[model samples]
Target: MNGHALELGGIEKRFGKQTILKGIDIEARPGEFIALVGPSGCGKSTLLRIVAGLESPDAGRIRSGDRELGELPAAKRDVAMVFQSYALYPHLTAAQNIAVPLVMRRLSGWQRLPLIGRWLTPRATRDEIHARVRQVAEQLEIAHLLDRKPAKMSGGQRQRVALARAMVRDPRVFLMDEPLSNLDANLRVHTRSEIVALQRRTGVTTLYVTHDQAEALSMADRVAVMIQGCLLQLDTPQRIYQDPRHLEVARFIGTPRINQLDARVDDEGVAWVDGTALARCAEPPRDRKVVLAIRPPALHLVAEHHPRGLTAWVKRCEYLGTECLLHLELESDATPLIASLTPELGTAYRPDQRVWVAAEPSQTLIFARSGERLTAAEPRLERSANQPEKLDV
Candidate 1:
């Protein structure tokens, strides 16, 4: 089946006094996988429902290819939705469940009549549907479970059945809303790869909605982050993590959360944190306060006597096998800072141990007071003649 590009223009939705989606716009290229992710009540699922024609938007238009989807009923939209619940029929076997859509579409009402419908239905039609069902089941590796009912299947097995049902339709677009949320942690990870492979093999344009950021980052070609009824950022996972357009995006995309420290830009356009020079800004200095955001991995711990580093007291250390996270409080301002350390280096420090921390100047991000990102052209290092020499480690 050939995929078609899908577009949403200025979509808006509201219920009573509460607004859910606020003039959101997005597009998915043909055969591309886009993930919509956000916290609870952020309208990620609502947006997916709107695209599937399951919910009406207060404003805006949905278009697939050159066809306008306005006023199109859910059945006529030609989009297949795999709901979060799997929504499989408990009484029907997997094969029969996957054949439901075909039975409704290919058989006439009179041919669908209980026992007599089997006699009335054409032999060729029944054979065709059975073949199609088996083909999809095989693709999902659920051919052996086709005769089993929903109650006899595991969560992952049932999920595969639902996907087979949707795939059998050969729709222009696929909408999946948290299809992996019901599975266990290991199963969820396994199923994520399966779903991505299935989508690619079928060349289907898909939109996946989930509250799990890791799933979105790992599975999608592009990710859209929604918060408070707004589409905060939409970009590749790498760009979204490395260079977030807004402070909210930066804080939401990373683990251990991005560190926010109060800082000042001096007359020489130098950004200082706890009296330690961090980076030189390209923007003209106004002696105004700004918020500096640094990821935990970008900050490194150093000896307490390092002159260019900020002296801090280690508050705690969390060892996670692969790495350690050190929580420290700056002595100059008492602000909290977190540094991701190697397992070896982290084991040497204990709580209340005095140390110094410095950030990688190139990796630091500066945000205005209003939460907008401040672009830096060049960042120069600051040094003092009388202070102890700086240490690279």
Candidate 2:
């Protein structure tokens, strides 16, 4: 089934005197998967709760398609949430758990009582509910576990049961809050693909919340980065990584973290680091200090005396099967630097080995001290190879 467009406008939430989410706005296109990701206590979960109606926004509006959902209770909103804890009833079998939503929505109170309720419920209604539960269980590949209680099922099985329960209702919007956080690493990876596939097959509008960057980057059509109760950036994964709008967004999105180095812009807008010219700012801020952010992959190791490289000493090496990380310290100011390399290249370096680190000019980002991203002219070396060259503005 096609899903409804979900919109959250100027969402704000607070816990007593502390604000948890500041004026957050997101418009998720119908059938799109959006991931809300950030470090712990960044209000990712709180925003999801607001959309699910578990929590009320201190100020904001939530809508599905053309309908205003702010006044609707959780159950009547036609939205389904699979929580971090799975929230399955311990005493209920998988089938029963998956059938709960349908039963509550379709059966009268008198027809919900144990033995007497079954007699009061029509055979057709009972058959419909049972059929729907089995259909959802099969879709999630958990039909075999339908007879077992939650305690007897593995974490993955229970997670599927939770998913089936949510999907059985055919919700217009689906919310998942770290649904695979409890699984083992391998299973978490495997289940991530499963969830993405399921969402695609059902064409549901999904909002997934997690602190895991990998999950957010790989599973979402677009990712929303939240920080300190504020929405920092919301864009496609590629843009979020390569074209971040803020220093905080750049610092939070990458693995091993993006390298931030001290820099200064002169009267002519040339940015320099340790006396070496790096880039030219578009709007020259005379005598202003700034930060240069470069992803690890944009750095390379060179001969110690290479003119274009920054002198550094290798501190250690981490060999991650397919890639390696060289932890280093700048010889000029003892600043920390990291370089991602191929396994072979990483193994060639040793602790205390002196090397030079060079960055790709096109990949460097300039940011003001206040964490605002800055524009810069394309950088190129203009002087002799042995002398520092001023970046042309």
Off by over 4 Å in 2: 304-307, 380-393
Model 1 lDDT tens row, 126-176? 999999999999999999999999999989999999999999978888999
TM-score for each model:
0.93, 0.95
Evaluated at residue 127, the lDDT of candidate 1 is 100
- Backbone clash pairs for candidate 1 read none
Score candidate 2 by TM-score against the native: 0.95
* Candidate 1: stretches off by over 4 Å: 284-287, 305-308, 381-393
Clashing pairs in 2: none
Candidate 2, residues 1-393, lDDT tens digits: the string is: 588999999999999999999999999999999999999999999999999999999999999999899999987899999989999999999999999999999999999999999899999999999998988888888999999999999998999999999899878899999999999999999999999999999999999999998899999999999999999999999999999999999999989899988886776676777657767678765448888899999998876655457888999999999999999998777889999999999999999988888887778889888888889876654433553443222
Local lDDT at 389 for model 2: 48
